[model samples]
Target: MTCDYDVVIIGGGIIGSSLAAHLASEKNEKFKIAVINSTGLGMPASEAAAGLLTPFQLNELENPVRKDFCFKSFEYFPEFFETITSGSSAKHIDLGYRQAGSLYLIFSNSEFSQKENETRNLKTIEPRLSFLSKVEIPKYEPLITRDVIGAYHYPSEAYINNPKFLKAIYLYCIENKVEFLNTTVKKLNISSNIVENIVLDNGQVISAGKFVFCNGVWANNFLKEIFNTDKNIIKAIRGEIICVKALHAMPLRKIIFCSNGYMLPRPATNAFETDSVLIGSTSDEVDLDKIQPPLSNTVSGISSLINLFKTLVPDYKDYLVSGCWAGLRPQTKDNLPVIGKIPEIENLYCSLGHYRNGILTGPFSGKILKDLILENSTEYNIEPFQINRLFETQIRGIPKYASI
Candidate 1:
């Protein structure tokens, strides 16, 4: 059967673009690939992200599978960032990649002891991290609030200028001859058990051998419509960030993280060209009862972030507010990403539900998906991320679309 392309990837965010780039750059194989996005590049999560790459900070006991996945993905960033930036079209792109590490602040004595144990256990996976005394905390971040009882430093962690990184990857994908279509996928044309065609918003039908959903939170509705499964496996969690420029030198050289949220030092935008710090965020799950919620900054969200800054940074008044924005993260029921192919639907694959770690895991997930499509193998076992697990734990009822 002749198809328009070998693969049709929906979504132009980090995951979709990365997959497009990886597939197009395969050494011996040439496959026609197209990336379709309703909105232009970086409209939602990818643009509003702070690009913190600290998977070591995750609590292993909480969700070990996700933690392990994040650590592996974080380890791949250095090489991944280098490769994407080295592309001919991406030569001038400055990703603002930094390995300055992250400080997880401890607030109470119990919290300090808890983190001490956590850091001790973390040494097996990440030996570069070390716990710091309250007195020693100021030595690392002079501007940290005195209320900190202690802190843990993950030296191997890093961050990037997300906007520039996305731009570079997008340009690199285009340079590699990956076509990007700016249109919304209205529906999936299915026959038997496979998706044979993608219907666009403009009533155009695109046929492809394989279809991958990298549309993040939007995938929830897409999956529901195509499979007739009403399960809300993925939902949008809105996160808000406030950008502040320093009046003097930069606030801190490293990322400061507390229980509530974290602060990131980001490169100044081209428009302003000033030193800036990013304070974020509020994880508000979208009310499923409402119509699709528009991504917008709210006064209450900004105020909550301001309170976080006041609690974490000393002399927070020294910084002037620059800007604020919000993005929706595709959070899953188990808080782990959904990867691999759909069980019943042949040639249908998904790499969504990344929540907050989308940017951190984007490169590696892309590589994994590319391997699955080309070599039919993966470096990491992807069974744990299969979409079937969502149906396996179905206490409410069987999946609405279950073919049984």
Candidate 2:
């Protein structure tokens, strides 16, 4: 049987698009790749991401494997950004990558002490981590309110313009001849254990040698349909962000964080036309069945973000609200990403569920997927992210859908 393409990746977000770009970059064997998406590229999470590259969450991650994964992805970012931008003539596009570091504000002596201990523990892996005293906080950010007693600074942390980064990867994929199909997948043609073809909502059928599910929160729908189970392997966590411009002059030079939320310098876009910053976010888990638009910012969510910004930078309370938006992050029961081949299904795989770390880990995740498809060994530990780790013997029979 002849296949229309070598691989068909489902999802246009960073994870899937990065995988498409990686496959397109292969010199030994050029894979004919097609990316299918219901919405436009990076509509939900990818474009809406605040683009923080700090591994400070390392202190919060209990799993050793996850800690290493986060750190490795953090270390791999510089090269990944360069690789995506090298040949593209899109110099006009500001990818907004900067290594200016991040500061987590501490409000009281007790909070400072707690954060000091936290930074000390994190210093083993992140040596650059340090605590700044109340007097020293002004050295990095003078605009921080006096309520901030101190802060923990990660000097090597970076930030990027997520939408621009996604666009760059998408352009790279197009330059490498990757086809993008703009439609929703209706179902999979599963027969005897392999996904031979994908049926679209428009009644179109496309054949492929292999199928990869990367559709983020919506992956739960496909999983339920294929496994004929009510278990939601991947769930949606909604986060909202608001963009504001500094009416007078730029008030921040580095990313600032507090207990409420975070404010980071956003590269001035055509909409702002001046120095601006992104203040966000609120993480609230919503029932998948209830979200009509799937992604949208609530008035309360926007108000909370504005309050967070005001608390962080009380001196600059006169900022202009440019835009507000929301996105759904794909989370798993265990909170680790689902990458690698699916159990019992030949020529089928998944690269989903990176959750909050999708942007930070996306390019490397793509590398992992490319290596898996090509049967090449990867240096990073991927055993913890396998399908059987979650599904086990439950993946026994063919999908409930009709087969070709």
Candidate 3:
């Protein structure tokens, strides 16, 4: 059926932005596109992301789908970042781009054994990661506290200023021309297993040739109605972080992670001569609106960081507290993201259900989604994330709802 646009993407989070940006760049003068989101999709989760871009694979044995996607996305950032900044106006300088490296600090033997095996297997597929001995830790981060232990350092791991990156994508996409629909999508109108129209909370109805339900935790609700879920595909996972500005100018050389928490240093500002540090975070599952940090909880979420920092970097105690906040991550039961078309919906597709590692997997997701929509062969396989798995999860006793 003819429609106003070639594609109408739901959810304006990072995945939606990246996809729109990529389509704008690739489509050039071709297909028209639009991005839609909920009343508050830009709040919390996407805005508060730690924005870590490490390439280290996790829980491969338990969820190879995310492991595969993480590696695929990590490999795309270098060129992806290039594509993003290619035609930006000369007035703006590149913001907080860190190609320095990242350390997955290890203390316990269990973490060591698990990471070591994953690193070894990853080495065969990607020669990008290497294990760092305890002695090497001090050399990489000279300011590292004396209590530091052995860590796995990914030298090519890069990072960006979260706010700046978000703004850049918005600007670049607009320049290249991607329509953003800022309204709450009430429901999806479907018939014969195809998305026909989107009914927005604002009383507007829009139709398109294809629909991508990349609505993070909200995906399960609609997927349950559209396609029954069986396995734990997408769950709303909560996390928190604290930002501290140090009295002394001692900032971290690389992103610091311990079994307890992590400390990421922001680029220096006049207000922050040395720089600000992001020490976070705690992982839990809860609804966003129901979850607000009580004053008592402020000191609670940070307790882990305080203890871990003392062990990873003794000097952590010397820093002054700047600010603190909380965020939610769309965690999947299998800890992987769903890509490609939905089995039940003929022309409907999704790229959501990415858990904690969404930041690490954002880039490759865009390319794959665009390629899939156009029916092009992708560099990596996406069969592991099919929405059909959600049907299995529903059979196993998971609650289902409609698009929120």
Give me the candidate number with maximum lDDT: 1
What TM-score, over all chains together, does every model reach?
0.93, 0.93, 0.86
Q: Candidate 3, residues 11-129: lDDT per residue as tens digits? A: 87778778888888888646888888765543535667777776562545656556656777877877777777775541265557788677887776888887787778767765767
Model 3 regions lying over 4 Å from their true place: 39-44, 57-62, 106-118, 122-136, 228-233, 269-274, 288-299, 376-379, 393-404
Show model 2 residue runs off by greater than 4 Å.
Answer: 28-30, 40-42, 269-272, 391-404
TM-score of model 2 (CA atoms): 0.93
Per-residue C-alpha lDDT of model 1 across residues 180-254, encoded as one tens digit per residue: 998889888776777889899889999999999999888877777654566677887888999988898555788
What ranking of all candidate models by lDDT puts the best one first? 1, 2, 3
Candidate 3: worst 10 consecutive residues by lDDT?
Answer: 395-404
Better of 2 and 3 by TM-score: 2
On the 0 to 100 scale, the lDDT of residue 243 in model 3 is 74
How do all the candidates rank in terms of TM-score, highest first?
Answer: 2, 1, 3
Clashes of each: 0, 0, 13
Residue 368 shift from truth in candidate 2, angstroms: 0.7
